[model samples]
Target: MKYQVMHDSGPRLRVRAGQWAFTKEEGYGLASLLLDQDFIHDVFTSYRNGSILIYYDGEVENKQRIFDILDGITIDDLFEAEPTQTQVSKEITDDFYWNISGMIGRRLLGKWFLPMPIRNAITLYRAIKYIWNGLDSLTSFRVDVALLDGAAVTGALLQGQYDPASSMMFLLSISDELEHYTVQKAKSTLKDSLALNIDTVWLVDDDGEEKQVPAMDIDKGDRIKVRMGDVVPVDGKVVDGEGMVNEASMTGEPLAVHKTNGKTVHAGTVMEEGNIVVEVYSMNKETRLNKIIDLIENSEDLKAETQGKAERLADSIVPYSFLATALTYLITRNASKALSVLMVDFSCAIKLTTPLSVISAMREASDNRMMVKGGKFLEHYANADTIVFDKTGTLTNATPKVVDVIPMSRRYKRDEILRMAACIEEHFAHSIATSIVNQAAEEGLKHDEDHSEVEYIVAHGIVTEYDGKRAVIGSRHFLFDDEKIKLTKTQEKKIEKEATEHSVVYLAIDGKLEGLICIDDPVREEAKYVIEELKSLGIENVIMLTGDGESGAKAGAKSLGITQYRSQVLPEDKSRIVEELKAEGKTVIMVGDGINDSPALAAADVSVSMKHSSDIAREVADISLLSDDLYDLVTLRKLSVGMLDKINTNYRNILVFNGSLLVLGVMGLIQPATSSMLHNLSTMIFGAMSTKSVLSDRDISNDIEVEAIQVADAS
Candidate 1:
């Protein structure tokens, strides 16, 4: 099909043939023909040499090569060499000489010189640049890289508008990984997350009633409430609520978590709380719980962690290629060996393997409900030595239910106190409010739509009158600072226990502390397996970082066997911690599900976030797990390590394969056909290797590094 040149910058032209985009080979080929027929023809005719040679002649390849030989020499120098008396009469060189000489005058000396030869030269130059640029992107220090955008890749395949050689290399490489056994295993992650039924949504009713469903709408450090019938919104420690929760979705355990104000809970767990308010601290995906799920599911990442040696080697190859060619000729005094060195120095295997491993690992991770956005992070994940975890979302669930309600004043009945708090909290959509309202409902109290005029306070407390007695429910700090309410000893103890065991909600009636409610967020059962797997994968240190109170954080950490812990840590602290680890020469991989974790994730060697991760976290994370299962972490590490191994092997093979050709060429043992076949075969082999990234090993065996996640129910 005829394709037109759609774009041109000097000699670099982009032509679209049907749906394909062409750059070097096909593009250069077409441009060369145009240059010769139009521009070269004009110059030849202008020079009065058009009748001497034909432009479409099949002998152009040899003609161009000969032109290169006499590149700087004038027409007279060619004939100056003395010819034997017998050479002119019957020799092949003699016959070829005049024909070439005349052709040079007609084609080489005119516009054809720049249009045909120079065009092909520039195309070759562009091809080499594209390859080098791709390699640069894989290094620690980012280099300018151009992508064969979807438009480019698709266009080339459909319209045949691309350089056939370059396109074939990339697409064929993709095909190779697809055919490999291990690469196929990684490819299965995409479907698993979608199949797990972990998606969370908000229950907004037309009647103005809204319920919070776990797995969605998770803001970092925001309180979320789960009712007796609903799912937990995110991963968090129980802080001021008591409830029974079913966590089979995450932990594969049937036992319920009797979570009360200090335990962690996972998303997708069913709530069995009697009554409680669960403060939300990490609904990172904006939907409340999807962020945690997204983190656990993405077992793959695109970050590459090539050592200094690999990087230096990648950078040195180009110069080394020229050096090898020069030294071969110097040592052997043979053009064949030097040519072999130069021609076989493409660096395909070394360049392709690193990215291929990342790609395959990412796919494998997704099979276990992990989604990785790129191959770059997958490389980095394998190198992580220290993993900083967020306690609330990382180790605990976000489903806090109302467990206990204590009345300080004898004038108020326990049920009346609960109903008043629930009535006033109806306007708020927070987790605490849900616990109160649901608690009131379970007692079969018919809610009164008529509410006495109540004032909505900001971050302090709510104020209103109940049963003609002034009543309010708010945090201790808010009441003391905003409303001038002092706490009694008994109330202080209640608040202390709430803060220590779990998150708490403070209730005050008529300007004094009334009582406290404790909530719990239990550890996810899958977390244990995930941790064990990571340890098995060779990660010796597991640290928990949380903004929650120390006792609450430690309580949950101990239940899960994590001794290294940091509580009450802010977002800035998280970032600083990662930097400190990196400074200590530790390769840190951070797994988090909140916006607060974005900076830390960006700062770490590699960061893997959940699909429900906050926008900022997702933006910075190298791998995105669309599913909410920690088991995916194990698959990611395994696939990544395995993939890298394959890549290294391929790199060594390329060196040996190409190096052997130079030796054979020097000994005069290799023919043109044999050398050409090897060269072509290497390209196919490299492509096939890249395809292996997709066709990963299907075994979810003992080899992979799975995160030790402990899924538990807080009931």
Candidate 2:
């Protein structure tokens, strides 16, 4: 609420403060009566900036008119006007409100309900005790967030960190036990196609002390210096210097990165850091780390937001004797019986179990060579039915072997022919060029010094004077397009075979086809298994997208069990394909790895980019797999669906527990302390249950008893 003293005479006024929420809600402001309006714009005209306070005039209606501009203000519009305030305020989590409410409830109990001083003291003491109890619960949550990876609730149980809270309790509350079983799914795994070592980076270093022994080691409290064309490594404050940073990674804002002090910098963003110095606000572990991790892991669960209700339920319950209040109330809603049951509705079941279970599952996945950034993603992995794949480095081995090297004339032997080709190719860095170089090296053909003056023509053939023939070697289309080199039947047949196999480039000499080389990039061994497993998990369509020509795309698709293929697509066109699929009512999960694949990756309903992919691609992608294992999708899909079920179950459980406990809370049998314990317990139980789905029932059944014995022995 906003108020101003009429010259600070009648009464003292507090400075107005807008409650921290987005403009989608409303801001605190007092209106003037200039035009019989209750809003701030009755008299004063508003400037483009959103700050309406200092802009107020002496006329009350004028003041209201000026402030009325606020109603037109939204987060999107504000960013356009002010442009710097992109921080959409995050509503404080339930922990804050419920804790304060519990205090208020305690004070009410002591002052109005109790007559005896001793009773009042005891009541007040119980309320004060709950505050510390809440802190401990919060501490446990903090620890879980720090060490946990994968689903928010499932991955937190590795060390039995919250052992007193039954882990399976969450499961019982969150999911109906499954009744079906399955084995080997999908057709086959797609081939691995992630190319290693083909990235360009522009590094931005904070602290400005590169000489200070391992610069990343130094503690940063000062402003970081991120110049133009550099990747911002960590979230920092603009303390010292700045330039325009490309903030497309975080906000999807298509603007020059503006520079100002006190602005937050995110990792994997480019400095476009403009001309200002900002301080380092948070580093690797702190900063907006949790939020970013949440974006990666949480797969749109509408239920998890009820965390506040869980806390309030914890605060509202009364101390009770042996019987569980929540269950008693559900069975019979008597004031005394329900209060006792409400005391047992400790919502810790929701808070503790899910995260712990996910953490454990992620740890397990890691043991099997997968790194999950957070548990929320693991929990949702089971629900993802569509899996898209990038062609180049993800499905096919980046390296291709030269299988057939034919020469037009017997005058040139294979080795000499390859040596000349590799000589010209060495000047270029295209995929085919690298393949030729690698093949020549494999054949032990030494580099010749004579082919020194080589020039690479982008999107065309390489031209070099090898033995002074003005050799032009590239695509047959390149020669045809140049309208220069002609191919004889012998050379034409050879070129046709090479091109048919998807080998790039045609060798031409003295305006005539010389010979052709066939290079084949074989599919990864794991491709077949991954594809089959994904199909089993219910991926409706398995398709391949590539810039590789149709023959090569079809060959890879056929070999890897893909029925649909798009070849020779430009980078922008890949996302377009995904758009088409979405138009057809498909929920696509685009998996890609390349600097060129960023747009397509972002366009997919759920994006999965290999960790080894381009930074831009990874930054834009929804899910970043840290390895080139196609089979990992099985684990991801399994866990994601499982977590969604758990989330669903947990939500139902919260409603059930609260539905039963609310009656008890209204009655005298349920008091604050016991209710808090029960509430936290309920949260913990639900949390544990949310995590158990990380492994299927069969997987768990197969190893439990024996593993339990082993675990006990180890302990």
Off by over 4 Å in 1: 1-315, 363-368, 424-436, 446-485, 494-500, 509-511, 568-585, 594-605, 611-622, 693-715
- Model 2: per-residue lDDT, tens digit, 573-678? 7878888888888778887876556667767766777656655565566566766666566666766665555555765777688655555555645643344346
Residue lDDT tens for model 1, 449-512 = 4457666443345778766767777755556666787877876675675456775566777777
Lowest-sum lDDT 10-residue window in model 1 = 42-51
What's the TM for model 2?
0.52
TM per prediction:
0.53, 0.52
Off by over 4 Å in 2: 1-123, 126-381, 406-417, 424-433, 448-494, 507-515, 611-616, 652-680, 691-693, 696-715
Please give the distance, in angstroms, between residue 623's alpha carbon in candidate 2 and its true position after superposition.
2.8
Error in Å for residue 171 of model 2: 20
Task: Please give the CA lDDT of all the candidate structures.
Answer: 0.55, 0.52
In candidate 1, position 373 carries an lDDT of: 49
